[model samples]
Target: MTSFLEKWSARKSDKPKAGMRSAVDAFRVRVAEQKAYLAEFESDGAGFNKWRSTWFQRAPGGFGVTIGRDSIDAGQGLSYVVVETTAQVAEFLDDLAQHADNDVSFQKALEQNRLRRAALLNSAKAKVKAPAAKAATRKPATVKATETSQVSGEASVEKPKRGRKPKA
Candidate 1:
């Protein structure tokens, strides 16, 4: 079979390390485990598209993430990573293992933040209600009268008595 890298992928500066091909299988192993975990949580797609996505950039044998067209509106974006050396790939595997733990921590943090926001909102609501509640609980104030309400038929009575004076 073709080597892990060939043609354009062959690094001009770093000759494909003597042992790279053999150790490259390790990349597959790490990728495999990631796929297995993804398999359990999968909700769509078939084959690798169903599980954790795997893409190869031949010139570099690098991998990275991109949002699949189908999931765009759902806001489910993709995360990509590539390992150029065996060390990087090893670190990637280790990171994958730690990712499980990280995922748990992330969830816990999200839940905590949600609870905190809820509590703050409740507190604000209580503060908003407090003044109105106190107003309701207190006795109503008596009205102080300054001006009297106008009666409907009240009219002026001082019409000039037209005593006709002597015609000028």
Candidate 2:
């Protein structure tokens, strides 16, 4: 038998099926359109450059937020963070702390943040109802076993058989 690597290598030279090629091309087009839309959105004053703050500032205290490559100080009550060098990260954390101290919204957001341990525990546990218990609670299926016996010309009861009946 050909190894997986060998098979894969052999298949690599062959062109994808027409349907698959069209699907991939369609996906690429969609991705490009999305990228363009995002670019235009960002370029506008209401976009990422402005922290999308205008959209959020519909209320007196409302604010929009956007994360930067270097920092997590998005204007909203939340931010996405990226860790780089240790010193830079330390400095960023210090700045974030200072910002949080001064910003009531950020402080509130931080207050609402779930602890890592609690989040992990919550994620690890699934809350699915037991199917077996539900099945046990259901009424047992009633069997219709009565059939006319051709030989005796009388009705007889037998457990219903599953699947196709054998032809005599």
Error of 1 at 22 (Å): 44
Runs in model 2 lying further than 4 Å from the true structure: 1-84, 112-126, 130-136, 139-168
Error of 1 at 116 (Å): 0.2
- Show how many residue pairs clash in every candidate, following the order shown: 2, 0
lDDT for each candidate structure? 0.44, 0.42
Candidate 1, residue 167: the lDDT equals 85
Q: lDDT by residue for model 1 over 36-114, one digit each (tens)?
A: 5444324332433433343222135743322121111111222345556434544554554454235654334434544
What is the Cα-based TM-score of model 2?
0.26
